[model samples]
Target: MLRPQGAASKKVSVPPALKSSRGVKSWKEAAAWLRARGIEDIECITPDLAGVARGKMMPSSKFTSNTSLALPSALYRHTISGDYPDETESFRYEARDSDLKLEPDLSTLSVVPWETDPTAQVICDVVDTDGESVPYAPRNVLKNIVALYAERGWKPVVAPEIEFYLVAMNDDPDYPLRPPKGRSGRSILGGQSYSIAGINEFDELIDDIYHFSEKQGLEIDTLIHEEGPAQLEINLRHGDPVALADQVFLFKRTIREAALKHGIYATFMAKPMQRQPGSAMHIHQSVIDEATGKNIFSNADGTPSQEFFHFIGGMQKYVPSSLVMLAPYVNSYRRLTPDMACPVNNAWGYDNRTTAFRVPLSDPQARRVENRLPSSDANPYLALASSLAAGYLGIKKEIEPTEPTAETANEGSIDLPRGLLEAVALLEGEPDFLEVFGKEFIGIYAGVKRGEFETFMQVISPWEREFLLLNV
Candidate 1:
């Protein structure tokens, strides 16, 4: 899978070709306007549980005042391969191939910078012909999660810290050993991670990324050369979980598009390199009451709040099950190797890095739990939704987490599944992940993940090529 690497130092504004077309304040007017921009085509995109966009593009001339498109009602019912069965099997057993009405979500319209023709992008909601949200839509899944929180006068604020790398591929397999741009030597092209002095080596690449990102409104929170050679992480401010997920989807493409425009490649593989700290999307989560705007996790008498404990307890209680959604991809399991700043166990500690979850030493008013197990390969939508679901379970059951331990490494952290199969089993066995994410999502998700696992199983890797070619 192609993954993004490096923090876009900033997000650029919609380019000139896109400047006049901000949020589609009016889809009808915007559609008409786009039709006049010499646009020969428009593509409607729907993101799947895997965070991959899938949908059809249509000729611009045919779009009229009341244009409506039909997508597979089962579109919400499949894996990334477009490989789901009909009514005889799976989630939409009753619905079959019914059309899901496509209505434009105007804010999502943007210029497809890489497209050859005059093309614009639009994201749509999956609705039945009756115009109701598809029950299994990933977007709707988050909408439902948000509504659940709203009912309790709470808001779940989530922040995503993304890590990616810059790479260059060459025709000769050994050529990749050189710096991507051919600038290799005693120079620190891809040396030690975040060495303050060595950090200057890649300033040009980092500078261009930040500039491009600034113009795109990514609202970048922070950027740092992380603890990996040529690896970096970008932080975004806390936002509503649904929007945060969408941002992550767009953010992935933004970095990729920008990096390519600058002659570099970005990757988000959880453990791209063997001996370094793996990329992680550690989530710092907390809840605030919508009415008072006061953080419910804040302790009134100057101690850790009970509400806070319940939330962490909720997350910790079902983490093993949540791992299926939290770390969905096969490469995700590789990062669970002990002591790589990637977690092997499910332990939470105060200001500690070894634990699976952690409480930062930052101000108490800003206190939050850091979920450290999720790999860089995790999908933002599924990861966030599953987490909310598990945390809610924690609140409902009022579970208390065992105290954080002083043991180093994986001594006391909860064990994570070693592969996609185990992760799927974890999801299936735990009622929290199953019920919250729903059986349909579980089925589709497991199906796609299993497909990926199978693909990996069939392919022989370089190590195997060398180690077992003759022996096996």
Candidate 2:
């Protein structure tokens, strides 16, 4: 079945990239850069939520193979339940049950600019042996949602502002785990928000991340030092919905990899510390109709107030049930308290940050609603999908949101259950969403998340022992 060495077979143009499918770099030019730099261990990585690799590591010899390889189902930080439906208990993977293949989405291939030695990484899409997408994969979920918008002659653009902290990576037997301080106490630089000099002082590391992102072909919108100390967020420009989701996935992976290479562990955990600002993945949303090239979220009357209010109403109506999607973890709800400006109530205001739903009323054409309930840890695809599902429900029903007062989201509860079970219970109580997103999906999501809660609860926490050891 092989063509002769010089068969003169016709060639097809596959753009300038993917012409040859063998190597860390999609282009021969990139491969040359690697050979010159003595780069090896061309790692093929898939990001899992629990911080594990679900793909294979390529040996230096076979780095130039022209065929794709198969891997177990990929992973991410938010699969709150069981492993991929088929993974066996043996290796925590069952290749036999796997109908999935890791197709190299060559567009994501990049050289790790931060490492001293040359290293290249590529993002792969998880596909079945029949070449169909695996439905449960996070990437596939986002891809499907994005496709829905395209099918409807509309495009949804998203930009997630990530927030997180940096803590010690080294072991200290005497000291508990905490962020490294001025030299020891886990304290961070104070009162320097938006200061150019502060950013300049750490220019080396900041610039490194920028360059790394650039090498990966991520559109760097802007990088800034957020309000909280040691809190940094890199902003990527919005693109096509599917591509934007890919970019977000890649962005998170790149940050994690680059930080680890520097021996500083970075966390995307919703709340790593009690006193600090919990990490949030606040999504700024807007939609455009492809046929007329007009933004659907914009009000044609040159006043977006009405459009903004409708979107706000959509969020307010579905947020209670949508909590399962937005805040998927126990730690996620810790950020929902009023003290953190976490939008404890489901109120919307013109250009306000205090409510769960905020209409950023800047320019009429550019106005959009900011959904603030999601944590940095929630799956962007499912969160966005749930939001879109809810928004569509709002539009269909011509929703008029109830007034937001003390009872909007129940401001009285001292300690709201952050557990997935409770969140799923609220979601189940709302039947309004079933007619749109379907009862099957809601049931599946609820079942999965609840299973995760059971699995997590089975494990004994060190905190339990610290207080109980002496007393017992």
Candidate 3:
């Protein structure tokens, strides 16, 4: 029989600053916080590997108690299809369902604006019974990566530009999605590039989005109509990497819920429509010296530092191998086609959108690198973690970048893995990636994706019947 191993579990420690000002470390503090907000229920949420919020709902009293929330440890092992892989030690149904503790991150407390009742929600970190973080948990993966930066007295500041599509609600996966009709009684055909009227077309829904985001403390900066029909983008204010990730997770959920209320569907599927441009969760990243609280990538005189080039070099070297994390599914690869806004390779350039990494036009304090490879569907936590880890390694090694590109990267200028399997193969070959992300996580992630790939191959695509069957 499988057994729960509590003896090896370590206690979870909350940072002093968090405990004092932001996080609730004791039940008494949690009770006070809930009582002050008049919150009757608490929604305990954990972001899975895919950044899907999964957890339990409980009364505020229970949430404020010493009792730890227990959920199946296998929650981390599910494939994108939401099914367990075959007969693995960690994922098999035959294995006794082990429980992991879900501790609420008090800093994430916010009222659920859509809920009629006085309900609040908090994000959680999955940990072992003894309180050690689950190694395979996506949030923990990011936490470990952040710790690596902290060791070198560096802190990663990140902001995410999240893009998605608002479509008519559809239940069938086989059916194509369509843009929802706006207030003008028509759906956009094409070319809404930052048009103010386009935003007003969906102002009702956008108003709700802003309302919910404000209530939930999302710190959303801008809302714009993107390049494609019904495409939308929301930018979150930059801060700590972990905090920013939490905001992204919550923001995505908030958008979906708000869309539903307005009788529409909000999707972050990278390539939802073949004719429209793909959605991406581009991350803007910069590092600060922990002790000095200054941007490390630039000098006091506002000149680029050697650390900046190494950071860029790190991204160029590691992004190829880390594509599995940036674009996890088969559909994600479709978004990386040439000539699209999305870059096909890990090329870096200044103010050039065609490159995978872009040095945005900003002053010394605000200088940052934008990683444009990650699809909006990619897990925000994992994507940010992978990018930061690579850049940190580059700084550690003092890697140098190539000359910055002055023009758009030409067609076929950079080679990239063409498929999910190819990306997985590259990841497996990159020892540094495997070592940095952890063998346990890499194994589970690759195996689950491989299983998903096999499932996908078993199906006959529509193209087969439309052309191949009659031709053959």
Candidate 4:
């Protein structure tokens, strides 16, 4: 699918109509707010397919007047390793790698507390030369899914619990990561498992995280020490899916920044250490009637509504095909092993962590489902989009679900993809997935993921050398 090289193109203007409607006035107001804060640099960030922040830093003076900036449209298609598949067509080089407009979401403006300089950041969307959203952009993909709910007068509320690890700083990838020494001058031992003292060991770092989160306007609800050493989990307050996704995107960056300031490394890698539980971005979701402002998952009599069952049915029907979006990387599958309390099958249950879909204990109004399959490395935007879309499809089609499992789902027989390659194959021709996430988008995404998998397989792992090299 390689295209012949073409001449370089200059600026691509935002469509005049879109510029007027999509937060143009808000951007100017943001510019004024930055000036008032004496912000010198503005980091304009767009989320790539991998949810990594990719963009340029510009002087505040330029950002104030220009409400729009341009970047290569192909930026969204890059793999985690910064390589591209030869067959990619979403942002072809034949288009001369043309500039796509970046329109800032002024509401995402936040002070960069970690930046020593007076700097701020604003999230932006990649807009085509036609001024419409690029369909494949992660943020735009999520917005489209959210719009589907809006059309039905229903809204999806999401709360994300992201688990991560804090390890000692090391430059060598081959070296094993270990928990860093906290303020008490002792490294964390294994199996903290919600110990209050375990969290207090890193009080200084955790406190700084809260302070930074406040400055950034992140509404973090709770922080707890997880099962693994130096592993921590933070829950973001629930709200609109799009807004929650934005918070997750920014929260990851902020935590890393805070960890660096404290001379430790915080990682969201799916499986950072062997024999340790992997990090996951468990998403808790609920639907509400936009007009009545009441939950749609529960009836007035405090009983589970048909919509709730259908939503679960939708998840069971579509989640197998949607695994590529939730568990995107090779390392992601390593975390899905059975008995780790991570999901190994497409099972639904009440208050059961082993099941992929969990209906947590809550009052009638607070009722919701939690998707436990997403790794921390997964893109929050894509993860949320796939989940909300699946639930919506269930509601629309009224799909019936299997009986909820009363025990561990891993003990049951329902099978899901066991690896990234298998996950890609499952997603390859899924009509339900293709209908929700366009064909072009899935094609580009799958190609990139498969390319990454091939790249990973080429590497000789330490385990292979240690065990198989001599034994085999």
Candidate 5:
């Protein structure tokens, strides 16, 4: 099967100064480091509400930290379809469509491994002209939630298990997606969960994924075949919430580039195919007290702590309202169907996969909750923010969770919103989310989703044509 290529395959040589985990702290350091690598271009980018990279690319020679790069503040207001919602009284755009400054986060600088030219990409922070952070920006939204934890003398650690599918390249949107042909020259037909041979089918692409990740300093704890045809999952090692979110953001682009090189499409759609299993980005999260440097979920005697139950209580209480962020698109709800290995309700259990919140068996130090609600299609930054925000609220409010179930939680009443519009409404109605995510962000986010849902309702589906055409 696939073997690790170790040091020999890690071809990118990072400069000693740039090798620091804290990254290049200043513009001068960034410039010197880029020059040492003979970089030609620099991509200054930031994640928008939809997690789509939006920014400008410039020659490395011209990219100084003092670069006055800015994009329209309205970028965050656009939906997945690139349509902006009609301005409402509370959420009207600035009269001039004012520009927001792009402040490069020097720590996120990394090489664009697949580029023909020696180009580097850095994630930027969206700031107002006054240099204050844009509260609604996806990255900033995540940072705000992290900052809230820090204010409480706690730090949240998150490890995300991202699932996606490899599908054959299709140019037409009307056609159904098909499993890509592997090295065996045949398309995958059945589920191949944890099959070594199944993973071997696309050994070349997996190798490239590893190499691309290595070039960018992204870590992959494990990669395995999932239950659907050509579906795969990558588990990232747990660390800081922001750092892990950044890795997940970049990893999605890396996987897509690697798959394109192999003449296939790597899709993160929640449910790309009707019959196949849907993809999920399950987040394993735990909080540690900054003073004690120990997991807050466990007590001194290694028993489950009150904070742990409160966190779960928070998830159950707030996850439904936060579904707008975790499941943003109209198609995301397709993956939450019952009996599909997906949890339909917000139930918690020990080592249970069917529950929305699963507490895996582990040591006291490693004790964490796995939030199985987020779809693979979610923006990584918002997903982490929403999950952590709920838990933070739980700890603050001291909410008590329901009894953990040992049996299937899918059979329980569906505690989640069934559609994008419903989710948007729930999120809008929740005052706590408005406070946590900010009223401006919720307004923009809900407006965008409403616009997208309206656009979706305008289209006619094949199912409608086939069933209602004659019957009606």
Candidate 6:
């Protein structure tokens, strides 16, 4: 059992900002900051393709800027099931299986609030021996897209709305998960969208979430109950793409740890239960002029700008091809079905939830498009990169979007790929995404997904055994 410790579990008069090591630029400064906090261990980690934390844990005293930490280069080619793709022309295994160096990104350094021992964790960048970034690394792929915006003197700002479920613990893989009983000793029966009572049922766990987030320097915009039983949504404040992605990555870990402390499991699965609404990572995105610091989506007259429409045009044109990244898993397609509060078409509209892209009603400075297609299960880094890459392409090509559909987009024919294999094929054929995200990454990523899909095919579900055994 994990016990809460450190300043997070206890009251401290010192503000989190003063205690945080986020601003430190060098290892010497980071060491000073950790020492001040009496940190005993440091977790040097990086997000893999599936957003899984991978790297080394070491004593703080041994964690220097020059610490030679490295992971197998083939780690990037690993499937979520921990199996590597069969060697093929698309994904050839390196005979040497070289190592990729891990360099800490000091800005992400934060205290492990729930740890029994005083510990710190920092996100790392994967680099080769030459000190150049590994192109396929999830973080590096995002950096590549962000660099394109920087070259055009534009800064992309994004805020993600993450939705998840709190479910009862299930040790067996065959059994379906159910909502956990709250403080009232009863399980949630029906939808409780925005119900204060629903949130209060798990008040203690929610409080721990806030406490853990505060200690990690993550800014929470809001927390609200969603339509599903025990379903909750968290909105993060708008910020830089990489920074926000980092928060989303860490926030997942924080929420799961906090839930476990309460004897429940917090799942980010796109579709965790049957007949329940699927969870989504709705990303609200906009680009700003770096020089004027003005939202490029709105013109000087505060009216919608051409760039805004083109951005939507980009999404409409390219997002289908990028769906593999946004909806990465076989289960992810289960959530993309129509009339489930999930968008099946890449339609754009004004304050319309049915459309894939909704332009929310706000002041010109805050004008942005909310991409509703990404599943909660997606890797934050890759999701952001794919979404931004689509918009970048739209702007670069001046692609024009279709007329905004005020009617229900879910009523229309499904425009998205219906399965993982189909999505992979679409992504492989699209040259625009290939150029933006790199051909090497697309190849390895597609190959890994194909392997996972093959594995899934080998498994016989209960549905097949129950019905097919007697009928078919």
RMSD of each: 8.6, 7.9, 9.8, 11.1, 5.5, 5.8
What is candidate 5's local distance difference test score? Answer: 0.92
| TM-score quality measure for candidate 5 | 0.96
**Candidate 1 RMSD to the correct structure:** 8.6
Q: List the residue pairs that clash in candidate 6.
A: none
| Candidate 4, 123-155: lDDT as tens digits | 988888899888888999999998988999998
lDDT of 4 at 238: 90
Model 2 Cα lDDT, one tens digit per residue, 172-227:
53344465442323455645466565455446556667777776667778766655
lDDT of each: 0.71, 0.63, 0.85, 0.87, 0.92, 0.93
lDDT for residue 446 in candidate 5, whole number 0-100: 84
The clash numbers for all candidates, in the given order, read 24, 4, 0, 0, 0, 0
Per-residue lDDT of candidate 3, residues 144-206 (tens digit): 999998988999999999999999988987789999999999987669989999899999999
Candidate 5 contains a number of clashing pairs equal to 0
Instruction: Using lDDT, rank the candidates from best to worst.
Output: 6, 5, 4, 3, 1, 2
Error of 5 at 69 (Å): 0.8
Residue-level error in angstroms, candidate 5, position 201? 0.6
Which candidate do you rate higher for lDDT, 1 or 4? Answer: 4
Model 4 misplacement above 4 A = 1-25, 88-94, 412-414
Give candidate 2's error at residue 73 in angstroms: 5.2
Clashing pairs in 3: none
Q: Which candidate, 1 or 3, would have the higher lDDT against the true structure? A: 3
Question: In candidate 2, what residue range of length 10 has the lowest lDDT sum?
Answer: 85-94
By TM-score, is 1 or 5 better? 5
Deviating ranges (above 4 Å) for candidate 2? 1-53, 59-68, 73-96, 115-118, 170-177, 181-192, 195-201, 305-308, 403-417, 427-448, 458-472
Quick one: best lDDT, which candidate? 6
